[model samples]
Target: MRFGHTFGRWVLDSLLPPRCMLCGEMVDEPGRLCAACWQGLDFIAEPLCPCCGTPFAMPVPAGMLCAACLAKPPRYRRARAALVYGRGGRDLVLRFKRADRTDMAAGLAALMRQAAGPLLHEADLILPVPLHPRRLWRRRFNQSALLAQALGRQAAKPVLLDGLERLRPTPSLGGLNRGERRRALAGAIRVAPGRRALLVGRAVLLVDDVFTTGATAHACIRALLGAGAASVDVLTLTRVVRPDIV
Candidate 1:
């Protein structure tokens, strides 16, 4: 069986050689970045706020919170992401999110799994931030759902697909401040009625492709909490380093 599988893979590779996801350079596997692209990624690490995962300019004692979190704490218990949303990270995420590169989910989710060890381990269920039906129809898929599904598989947890619903469409959040974004998203998302009982007392790990501001995560988390979720944590593929951009 192993030999047959190996031979089949060899044939497949010969016919359709793998290429890097970013630069299209020949590579050993699909959904992989070339060395240059890999090195360009600023994968987020320590010296960050324990609450929001925003990196500190320099090392600080453990348990310190960023100013934003300390002043106006977010609704979620915590948030973590794999990459800083710089030029390289933005390109990769746009391809996966807007260029119909669904195949990249697993690879990206592997990174999220590594970065979000504590969040995944503590989550009782995984839920993706939902897209409105109109947007979902236009895009043909929810990028966040794809990431959540991939994460669920990697973490060996149940993924609650469609457990959350976007109640209304909102305008572009770009250039909005946190307060503006929050107001725009108020009452825009909710936990599906049928999932309320299931959510009760369960620790939810909310998944998203990117974290710009806390608006989207906050909306989903507030809904989940209102529906009786014990708590919600956020895991994202990337996030804006300057979350104030939105």
Candidate 2:
């Protein structure tokens, strides 16, 4: 079986050489970036907030939370993201979400899997931040669900695609304050009726495309906890980091 699979792959590769996902430069594997594009990615690393995983400007003591986190904590116990939503990251996300690049799910999920760090190990199940039926109908797909499914496959974890539901459709949240975002999203998310019982005592890992403000993720996490989830962590494709440029 292995030999046949290898031979098939060899034939396919010979017919169509792999190229970089970003620049289209030849590479050894599909759904991967060449050296330049890979290095261009700002992967989150150490010296970050233990709670939210926001990269610190400089080295800090262990277990130190960022100022924003310390003043008003997020609902998720911990969070991590693959890239700072800078030029490169933003381009990747836009192409994936808006340009019919669902094929990038595996590549982007691989990136998130790397940044997941210890979060994946502690999580009992993976859930995507769902879209409202209206939005789902318009968009035709939930990018977050795609990421969650791909990441679950790579991590060998069970993905509950319908674990949560968006109760209503929200307008564009741009230019809204944190408080405003919270209000807009209040009562807009809940654990799926069918999954509520199964979530009890489980540690959930919520997946999303981007983390701009904690409002959306917080609402989802709160619902998970309210449904009896023991804990909730978050993993995102990219995040809006501070100007400090960690």
Candidate 3:
């Protein structure tokens, strides 16, 4: 029975062979990442910034905060990120964004699950920061919603895509400092009517693909809190941290 099952599995694999999304290398697994590519992926490990959860050289102890946090703390109660947005990390995100490689969303969400782990148990709903209707029409999909749905499946929570609405299309936050980013994103997001009760007095987990300046997430958190959310936690697949610029 075991050998028969193994042979059947091999036949199925041969019919639908797995391949790495980044390198196109044939893989032995179902997902897009291969063993070598997975090993090369740089994950954010320890000694991270408490405010935005970016991996740093030195640890910022509990209750203590990083310079970024001291200068301008984000609205969310806490944030966690899986990897730094550099090298293959940036490539992965851009590929998913511009190149239309929607398959990468699953791989990225898996990475977030690993980062979030048991923290999934702490949230009542998984909310994806919505995109403006104009942008959504152009892209035909919301990356954050894809991430939230993927995470919700693993976390066993209802991924709420319409929990918040983007009222306007905020300018790209590229090359902006914390203050500028915050101002640019302000008034861009709000809790949707009727849906506000879903988060009232509940712990909400905001999901996004990347944490750059955290402008978008902060805006979303502020709106959710205003709608009576007891607390908000954030999770992103990756974070952009350029030391030379920061």
Candidates' TM-scores? Answer: 0.91, 0.90, 0.86
Segments in model 3 whose C-alpha atoms lie over 4 Å from true places:
1-15, 59-64, 70-72, 242-246
| Candidate 2 positional error at 176, Å | 1.2
Task: Kindly list the per-residue Cα lDDT of model 2 for residues 84-165, writing each as its tens digit.
Answer: 9997898889888887656678999999998998999888999999999998887778999999999889989999999999
Summing lDDT over every window of 10 consecutive residues in candidate 2, give the lowest-scoring window. Answer: 1-10
Q: Quick one: RMSD of model 3?
A: 6.4
Off by over 4 Å in 1: 1-15, 243-246
Please give the TM-score that candidate 3 achieves against the real structure.
0.86
Following a full C-alpha superposition, what root-mean-square deviation does model 1 have from the true structure?
Answer: 5.1
lDDT string for model 3 (1-246, tens) is 646865776677568767786787987665567777777777887666665666666655555666776787778877888877877777777777776665566677888988884457889899998999999888867888988998898778888899999888988778899899998888989999889878889999999888887778889989999999998999988887755212
Candidates 1 and 3: which is better by TM-score? 1
The global Cα lDDT (0 to 1) of model 2 is 0.88
Q: How many Å off is the CA of 110 in candidate 3? A: 1.2
* Local distance difference test scores for all models: 0.89, 0.88, 0.80
